[model samples]
Target: MKRIPKSLLKKLENRKEIGTFRTLKTKTALVDFSSNDYLGLARLDAISVRAKQILTDLGHSANGSTGSRLLTGHHPLFKKVEQQIATYHEAETALVFNSGYDANIGLFSALPQRNDLVFYDAFVHASIRDGLRLSRAKSYSFRHNDFEDLARKIEKLTSASSVWVVTEAVFSMDGDSPDWKSLAAICNRFEVHLIIDEAHATGVLTQLTEIYKQTTIENHLTARVVTFGKALGCHGAAVLGNASLRDYLINFAGSFIYTTALPPAALATIAAAYEKLQDKIGLESLHQNIDIFNRSVVNLDLKQHFILSQSAVHCCIAPGNEHVKMLSMQFEKSGFDVRPILSPTVAARKERLRFCLHAFNTENEIESALKLLATLL
Candidate 1:
């Protein structure tokens, strides 16, 4: 077997020294407070049944997408699902990608050209940052969720061929959201294109369609990246924009063009998930759990430790990697599945316990977890 380079070994050693080394663990039977299945659709048997039915209806029994979408892999379900997603999201068009990461990479890398300027929130997802790294555009980061800072930075940029602003509807780590109205207003005032990653917001933010319908937000909003993996409890993602953006991506987005298309079954599952969204029972239950969790945090006097959020994701800061990891272990021992967000993933003192609320999480479970967390703290 070949040995890894000393540089790589040193990096691993550094992670261990800082108590930030990571390892994968199999799913356990602990009470759920960690997975991204916000609407509980991932484990909903009905979705599976519906997805199978969809595949049968479409006569798509193939096990794989043999080629990229532009090649032989553009299956019939792609068009149907894309149209469904666009209609659901109130977008002019929607173009599907293999995953959220691919969607972001494709959009950011392909849209911004040389002399184009991109101003993104400082704490936007790593995928977006990676995409920006591939772009020829000059990029700058504004303070997270700070519209004033974003405006100030844009004002400093006196000249550019084109300007773009990027942010997320809901930040994954902090579980906080940007003020969409304020952010959109800033983009409109500057006459810049606006892009929002709705990976953590899809299905979870029930008001999204109505929010997009507002004329003020609709005008300068260039694109939105929505994922099926989180709230939808499925795979794949889509870029929502006008037909021209879809056409441009189909032609120039390397991530979308080069990657093999998603399998027929995955598309079927996504369609099934979208169908489930219309029922509203799961969504209602999920929001109720979120409310319960929020109330529990306050009741247990743990609100100060938590980030303010109305989303399914809620993070409680525990500082050091060792400290946060210890708290996570304690929660696991108590039969809850809360996980720690370590440094490097976040900043050193901002390490936290990420609690993901779901529709299936019972009221008792929510209260008990917070009470345990409070005692542990």
Candidate 2:
């Protein structure tokens, strides 16, 4: 084989220098705190059973989508899941994508026209950033959750081009939320379109949706992206918006157009998960666990150490990448699955230990984790 490229070697060296080189590891069987399966639906026996039945009922036993949705892979289950999502989220229409990444990339890359200007929160997800990277539109980052800075930037750009304000309902690393009410007002005053990425918020939809409902602005701003893999504890994602926006993405979003659709079994599980959550068993338990986790954080006096988050995701900032990784190993050793958010993924000083709470996490686990955190932090 030819010698490894010098440029690639240099890139690896730079990653090592910053302590941000990446590797993959099989999941350790530990108490849950790392995975995005907030409601524990990922491994729920009921979901699996329902998925099996859905596959049986469909009379199709395929193992894959086999082709892009635009070609031979538009499964009937796709329509079923998309319809359920639209109804559940109260959107005029819904278009499902392979994953949250695909949904964000497809929407961001295609929706903004050449003359448009995109104003995104500085801390939006990496996929959103990647999508923005591929777009022809001029894009600028406003200070994270700083509505005033966002307003000023919007004012500067609105006259020259159509504007889109993009933000996540809950930031992944920081476990914080944008000032959506103020953001909506600013977007309305400037006649700018507003888009929200609800990947983190999907776990606590009632709370987040209430915020949206209370916003002073009445006009349809733009769109909202919700993913199932996080809170829904399943797979896939959906873009929620007016019928026209959905149509536009179908026509223009290359990520959606060119990618193979999710398997029918996956779609069935999504529907089953939502159906289950709507009833009291799973949803109520998840809410109760969130409450328990919050109280534990407070009781342990670890509140000062953690980012204030009402959602299932919580974080304790541990400045350097090395420090955070070491702390995560300690967590793992103690039988927890917490993960470190390293620099380059986040900014240098903003590294953190992310604890993803799940409904199935016992009170003992929550208390034990917090007690450990109190000692560690």
**Highest lDDT, which number?**
1
lDDT tens readout by residue for model 1, 154-207: 999969999999998899998898887787689678998889899999999978
Q: Superposing all C-alpha atoms, what RMSD in Å does each candidate have to the true structure? A: 1.1, 1.8
Cα lDDT tens digits, model 2, 38-140, are 7777788998898889889889858888888889888988888888888877677889999999999999999888999998999999999999998999899
Q: Which ten residues in a row have the lowest lDDT in candidate 2?
A: 212-221
The parts of candidate 1 lying over 4 Å away from their true place are none
Overall lDDT per candidate, in order of appearance: 0.92, 0.83
In candidate 2, how many Å is residue 239 off?
1.0
Model 1's lDDT to the true fold?
0.92
Q: What's the true lDDT of residue 261 in model 2? A: 84
- TM per prediction: 0.98, 0.94
lDDT of 2: 0.83
